[model samples]
Target: MDRLFRSRRSTVYSTKGIVSSTQPLANAAGTKILEKGGNAVDACIAVAAALAVTEPASTGIGGDCFALYYSAKEKKVFGLNGTGRSASKMSIDWLKKNHPQHIMPNLRFKSESVFKVTVPGAVAGWCDALGKWGSGKVTLADCLQPSIELSENGFPLSQCSADIWQGEVERLLQMNEKDENLKLFLPSEDWSAPKTGDVIINKPFAETLKKIAKGGKDGFYSGEIARSIVKELNKRGHPMTTQDFSNHTSTFVEPICYSFLDHKLWEIPPNGSGIVALLTLGLIDSLNRNGTIELKSMKHNSVEYLHLIIECLKISFRDSDQAVSDYEYFKKKFEADFHSDAEQLLSSKKYFDSRSSLFHPDHAITNKEMKEGVPNDMFKSDTVYFTATDSEGNACSFINSVYHGFGSCIIVPEHGFALHNRGGNFNLNPKSNNCLEGNKRPYHTIIPGMITTESTTNPAADEEELYATYGIMGGYNQPQAHVQVYLNMILFGMDPQEALDASRISLFAHPEHKKLSDRGEGSDGPSSNDITCVGVEDDLDPDVVEGH
Candidate 1:
């Protein structure tokens, strides 16, 4: 333990509370909430609002959010699906007529012209979480003060934000061939990106936050803010109505649970890809327990470890691509069968034992050769995730996203925020469960996860001990990162900060590999040779690289 101090980033240990986020200001905002005696839920919402101001390129009021709240009092984790749906009037007929290719031609278009925009659901999600799980110690207005002030008075732009802003602006400019909506994000009238440490403010956004602080969820969902959003969207060719915003509500659902070793993992159900993380972890656990692979003895990022992990991901992602979609639609189709199959896939020791027998320690299996499992399966700058835990042992694992950088980039001229392109995640195929429908949630990628230590004597006792609230953002990387982070701590025994700071790896489907649906029984799965197009950070040991 003493020698571990040699690492640059140490694990953050806080008994009072702790908040982790990609941006520093967002962390400070959540910490302030804790200082004011607010509980984990309040701190989580505060951190989310602050991120809207500080990390505008990645998340905002226009995006959707999902959360896993662990309540100390109840000793249970609750899942909140705060994702928004398409306009109540949207349909496939509209798509076929307007977008014949079944794809958004210009994803950067203004909100009115952007067909991929969805009613922003983050505000409703925040309110739902607070209303149900908050400590009731602080008013919503009190929790939002920091963000409102930041948006109104402005904060210095960090180097990373400036660079991303510039890159986005450049991309939009090249595609649109005009500066139609670029002015909304530029720090000054010259339309230049802010330099690092430069102060920038969005007075309109601040005013919008102020309205929400005063009126609660209705502040954003109804009346003035709502009217402005709809009017602007309608004017831009997309016919969103006030009803779409008003009817929006976040749902509190039972979390999907997976037990690993002595701990239980929790995640939001379909429409969010958290299941992929659970599935990937289950496969890894099964492999290690069966001695098909011994992870504890292998060095971090060793070829053996990376290969196995990537291969597991291949199966997880393939399942997710084919099966994951809106929960309502998925349930109506698969019902209890999905859960039954998932249990066998995850908890059935015999099931995994058979699967593990296929892997060769020294050789790689091709995707074509990789066999499909029984019945089940599983953005970019597009998302933001943060974790908050309070002294009461209550923890909140929160994730928010607009589905793409700058979202639709159509800043509501009145409210001063972009609409999310989450609807773009839906497909055009009528046979697909995730195909677009009016008032239907799209296939979502943002997921928040929680892990709690299991109780020995009684299953009911598990709720009392709060474990950790954590998640990694960045679209598809979310699930893969989840597996890596869990392993770094659970299997590798690294501390929290070290686990997060550790180098990461990801595996892409071999280019030549056909889509899972295209292959038949006994057909080759997603690999061509022992070496796949796997991406591993350069910081690993020399031997791992040489071996790969």
Candidate 2:
């Protein structure tokens, strides 16, 4: 019996509604919304706001967001791109004129530098989602009330949050010993990180939240808050202006999709990397159909299965790396080609047959030699994902992030919030599709995922059955993790908790990415060239362990 059930905890069973988040406070806030007659979207807003307070290191009002909402009435999924754009003046030309030495397309400037900040899109995104899908049972102010109270009254720091906060504060301190941006996060007497249970408060953040709640989106975008943001940004030598904030608007776009087994997976289109996940699913389906890798023959978590999945991920990432661009570029090309390019690459049998020919059943590819594709830099993402499902069947998959922990470490001293470093993801090379440009969105790693079953009668129609609103929130790991979690539920028939608790495999070496190291701007640690340095738990089958 013990061997049969390996989950850390039992799956939660809820009838009226359910909310899941990284922080308990966020989960509670979302649940409270649902209990108070709010739908999934409204609950999501509450959860997102609470997370902005409780998980400040990874998320905040200063970051960006992406959402996938499953509308029960329409029986369809909707996509939201709440991402912000780069400053109109912060271009490669500006870099050449200001700081010439750090102009490399791949190289990043200091994380704390002002150039890394983008006009935050989260506030507008939050308002936009509520306006479009909210139940009207709760206003934006109501959804934000929990977060405001949490920020003003403070909450005991959890162990995981405390550890991450401490490390980030240490990192920021090293970058600038006297940097006032992170002063509030630092301890007054003890230089050490706050221990678990330590009460942390941010009255300024509460006030800021109150202003936004009362003034609505305009409070943040058009009024005093926007002015203060621009003033502080300009004071730090950043090129951001009030117009940048005023012009910000979140978009409702068509969600990119691919079919897997009995379900369709949906994600927001680029400049986000959501397409990578869809591409991976397409490749897997292609491989299974082509008879190159029959998943039916390989056991789940078997060495062969793991290898196949890893290879598919690398290949998909390589393609997405070359293809994903600003929404405007991707949309024009996709429409112009009528999606023929995407179909030929992912759906057509001919392309998969060719790709399948490259896979060798028994050997591992070298680091440098690659006809298929090598992994790029390890994705170092710090983000949070939450899901809210109402009794009415509407579900919202929400994700928010400040990019790296504590974002740019450029806290808005008056507002008590950090600015995100999303702009750092943009390339400076003119030849690249994702090249840094004024007023353009950067390549985003944050993505939310949705899965829905096909309609019983009209299988290809837009009216699919809502299955689940699920997502995993690591940067580069997101898509790969999504693949694994999908397989866990679909292939292995595990409940949510069991699916989540199942052991994970982390691939460190991407032939395309430089091995991670302290030397690199975004790297968290040392890198390894060996592709086989995959992280697997000790609890896995001995056969799988021995095979690796």
lDDT of 2: 0.76
lDDT, candidates in the order shown? 0.74, 0.76
Error of 2 at 146 (Å): 0.5
Model number with the top TM-score? 2
Residue range 1-548, candidate 1, lDDT tens digits: 01222358766688898888878988888989899999988998999999888878789998999999887777778899999888978877776686555343221123223778888899999999999888888878888899988988889987766666766675444423234345557756666667778887877888889999989898999889889888877875676899999988888877886777666778888778787888777777788887777777887787888878877877766556554666654455446345444545567666556656666778766655665553444300468899899998889999988767778677776566777888766755555556667887876878898888754446665553556788987777777888888877777887877888788876653544323233221111122122246766666666776786
lDDT for each residue of candidate 2 in 202-297, tens digit (9 for 90 to 100): 888999999999998999999888888788888877889999899888888778788888888888877777777777777777778877778777
* Steric clashes per prediction: 10, 4
Tell me the TM-score of each prediction against the true structure.
0.87, 0.90
Q: List the residue pairs that clash in candidate 1.
A: 112-236, 367-524, 367-525, 367-526, 367-527, 368-524, 368-525, 369-524, 369-525, 379-475
